[model samples]
Target chain A: MIGFIIERIAFFAAIGGAGYIAFKGFSAIYRNIMLGRKEKLAGNLNTMLLVAFGQKKMFKRPIVAVLHFIFYVAFIVTQIELLEIMIDGAFGTHRFVYHLVEHIAPLRALYVFTVSSIEVLSLMTFFVTIIFFIRRDMLKIPRLSSIDLEGWPNMDAHLILLMEINLILNIFLMNTADMAVSNGAYGLWLSGIFASAFAGWDVEILHILEKVGWWGHLAGVLGFLMYLSISKHLHILLAFPNTYFTRQTPNGYLDNMESVTREVKLMMDPNAAVPESTEDGPVKFGAKDVTDLSWKNLLDAYTCTECGRCTAQCPANLTGKKLSPRTIMMKTRDRLEEVGKNIDANGGIWKDDGKSLIENGYISVEELRACTTCNACVEECPVNISPLNIIMQLRRNLIMEDSNSPAEWNGMFANLENNAAPWQFSQQDRFNWAKEQ
Target chain B: MQVKEMAEYAASGETPEILFWVGCSGSFDQRAQKITRSFVKILNHLNIKFAVLGKEEACTGDPAKRAGNEFVYQMLALQNIEILNGYGVKKIVTTCPHCFNILKNEYPALGGNYEVIHHSTFLQQLINEGKVTMAEGGLFKGKTITYHDSCYLGRANEIYEAPRKVLEQLDAELVEMKSCKTRGLCCGAGGAQMFKEEEHGRIRINEERTQEALNTNATIVAAACPFCNTMITDGVKGKDKQASIKVFDIAELLAAGQGLENIVL
Candidate 1:
């Protein structure tokens, strides 16, 4: 009875501690995402079904898509087992669903089939994780091993793969030991093969091994939950919402500036009444930092899976320019994290920092100008994230706010303002070609 | 070779069916002027009543808006909007994807809305309506012609079939580049990159795109946008295959296929 009490206390304590940490981590990320300006969201259900559930864009590369789909389905299917494990851990019960199988004959068959399928899927997950590791480390696929992905980003990918492998292995070990002790007919296909090695062992030792496997798997899952808010794995939860609120405008359409439109109206109609600015303070023209971006952009930063598909398909990146769409998303998320920390340190109010997203070298002018704004990056994103939009916003700040656009661009601006064309020709001679014909 | 002004039609209490929005390149660039002439020949042959903004037409401000100069873009857009509104123009057609994109997608927000169509689509409609007919065994007959997808028309506006259908009427084999349609490569000219020197890179985007077209081994590389035409022309020159492979706008091909090659250039 004392041992039972001690085990129960320990299990609940681990659960409580991990739950608290996970909640706090998620709340911090939520606060950071809320810092952006709100925009209307539409087509939520359709987008979620197509992008997140359907995995529509992942199929662009067929082999990887099939492998990833197996892993994704396995993770979801195993969640049913995870719930059982959680209940068993909390109550110190063994095989919490064993009563259902014992009571109903049809349920017994169903339970056996389900457990067998889970075992097969767990093994598939193990192999897929290994393949992912090889692709990242041994093959060093150019997209996966780009220079911008060095340091923590590279380690983060490796760590997640490693965690997945260990989790699947523990699930297998628990099944093997359970079959060894109970001589169970269910879950005995793959587990039976491993159980033979432990057949001669004492039943008590097999029980202890099963308990250790159970505890380790549950603990690892909880740890992974807490780690997600800080890792690129955040995409697992964020991709759904990110894709739902994606901008519905045509890819080529650049939004007009309202201020510029108002000025143009005044220019066209001299007697037009100018509306007073309703803003509480002076309105800044474009984005210079994370705060200026809309909430959808901020959500895009969090939704990035660092898959590098965008960069791989980018014409600018393919041509050896400094612009990497992956790097743009990474830097935005990093800068937002810094700003989030600063706000947290200042008791929930942002304290003016000398450093800003652009000036602090988080994203350089070279990278900004290198973008061709072809929307290829936007099109390639699996979660429908648009890094091109953020790049355009920063470029707007560079040109309008700071007058720091490239010299050639300034000349074009001048030509457009004076000649009403991108060239030096006069508007009076616009039809000269037709006259010559 | 008569191109009436909208003001002339307005003064005569007459309105043309469509307004030809002669973009800057079509109005000024030497190479693009040939495409303009060929399209005009098609319009004349069909006897379709069309007018032009002529001196009143300004740049649609596409380059300015793309280059991040909103003030200048709005200035140009508003000026052109005033002129277009004064003429009470209803429908517009242009040979430039840049102009087509801006007028069709961006102008409505600036209070200048019209039924804007690219010339490729316009010609495709004319052919379907039997207003324009191609000759049997025309100039482009029995030739393999690869169509280059312009970024603005293909991906930006989702127009891929109209140009291909126009090419189809010429009785030519319509070959496709490896990357075409929604996955089409840019000709290194969109986003106002036409006016500025390309940034440092291993190979120009147009050079890469052109190489793809060459790989198809088509005799003619056809394009719809003036920018793509110029870039692919330079790309062909760079490969020293200009003598072997020629670049022509779809309108030019259609004009030639109609035995109006004398009006070309």
Candidate 2:
């Protein structure tokens, strides 16, 4: 009795510690997102439902989609089992929910059915995860094997798969060990076969085995929960809000700079009436650092799955230019995280670190210039993340503020300024084709 | 062929059914002019009552805006809008996807709104209305022609079918590239890259896309945008395949199939 009571106390302590750490980790991410400039993102329920919950874009590759769906469904269904484990550990009793509901025959049958289904789903999830591992390592899929995922990203993926396997094995261990001790009293469907192997084993030994399973499974779940905030696995939670908050405009529309629009309208006609400015600081042209990007852009950086789908479809990447869209999102997230740490370390104020997203070790001028703005990457993202927008934001700063466009682009701009076309032909001669024909 | 300028229509107290926006490439490029004339020939045959903006039309500033020069983009956009609004132009059609995209999608935000249509969609409407009758056993009859999807036209605006439907009217076996429609690759000319040298790379973007078009084993590749036409034409030549595999604009193909373009080939 005393051991059971002690075990309950230990479970609570472990869970509380993990829960607090997870809360802190997630709060840090929220602060990092809030460091960005403000832009309105109204709720889009329909987009959220279709793209995020339905995983609509994943269906483009049907085989992998099926594999992923099985893993997702398995994870959700296992939460029911998780709840029963929590209750059993807290109350110093084995299978507490089962015991409470075992009296009503129909409810008992419901319990049996639910546990059996979870076992079958778990067994399937086990295989699917292994296949995903094999696909990543052995299949040599170009996107997965690209230089973008060479070091820590690759390790992150392997660790996630290994953790999933650990969680799954511990479930079977707890169930099968319980069946061995209870002599079929539990009646969990698939684990019963393994339970028979311990028919005449010592009861105390079986009890110890069940205890180990209980503790291992509980620890694994809590640990994974905490780890998600620090890992790319955050996508499992972020995909929902990211889809809802994605910009609602057509994929091609870059919102006009309100400042630039005001200048141009006034220039075109001196009598042009413009709205009064709401000035807090001098208006900067475009994004020079993480702080200049909108909050949603920062959120997009966190939500990236690092799946490399966008990189595979990018024209610049295909033609061997320096740009890879996936790398753009990854760099943004890295820089944002670094900036968040800077704020935290300096008495809650941001201090310039002499680094920006576009120079000397982050996204580069060559990468920014290489983009064709073709919308292929935008079209391919399953989570509705737009790396193209980030690239354009950085390019806007380079051009409008630094005047860093190429000589060829400068020539084009000059021609448009004087001749009203990208070339040097006179506006009066626009009809030359008609006359010459 | 005779055409009336929008200024003439305004002076005569008349309004044409549509304003034909002749983009800079269509006005000045030697090859694109042939495509312009072909579309004009078809419109004249249909008696569509279209008027050109002629010399009064400035560039739509597509390249400038895409290159991150908002100042230049808005400068040209507002200038053109003043003239368009002054004449009360109600409808517009253009052969270039860049112009069509900016005019249709971007202009409204800057106070220059009109009913805008690409020539592919416009030509498709003509076909659907039973006006663009194809001559039996026309010039491109039974030929294998694959259609290239222009980035601004196909993906940006999602008007893939109109160009393909127009190609189907040629009585040709219309094929598709390996990357077609939504997954279509760029012709390496978007985002103002046409005016600048390409970045250092293993190969050019246009050649990569052109190889996909060639893989379909079609005798000809059809394009909807003038920029795509130029890029792919250059791409085909880079392979030294011009003698066997030709690139033509959808407008030129449509006119040639009707025996109306007076095609030299």
Cα displacement (Å) at residue A95, model 2: 1.8
Candidate 2: residue A197 Cα off by (Å): 4.1
Model 1: per-residue lDDT, tens digit, A69-185?
998899889898888888888787888786547678888777777777888999998899989998998999999988999999999998899889878888888989999998865
Q: Model 1: residues >4 Å from true position, as ranges?
A: A267-270, B262-265
lDDT of 2 at A94: 81
Mark the 10 consecutive residues where model 1 chain A has the least summed lDDT: A276-285
Query: How good is the docking of model 2, by CAPRI class?
Result: medium
> What number of clashing residue pairs does each candidate have, in the order they appear?
0, 0
lDDT of 1: 0.86
lDDT of 2 by residue, A103-206 (tens): 98888888888887898898999999989888898997889888888888899888899989888888888888899988887778988888987789899898
**Candidate 2 residue spans exceeding 4 A from truth:** A197-199
Pairs of residues at least 3 apart in sequence or in different chains that clash in candidate 2: none
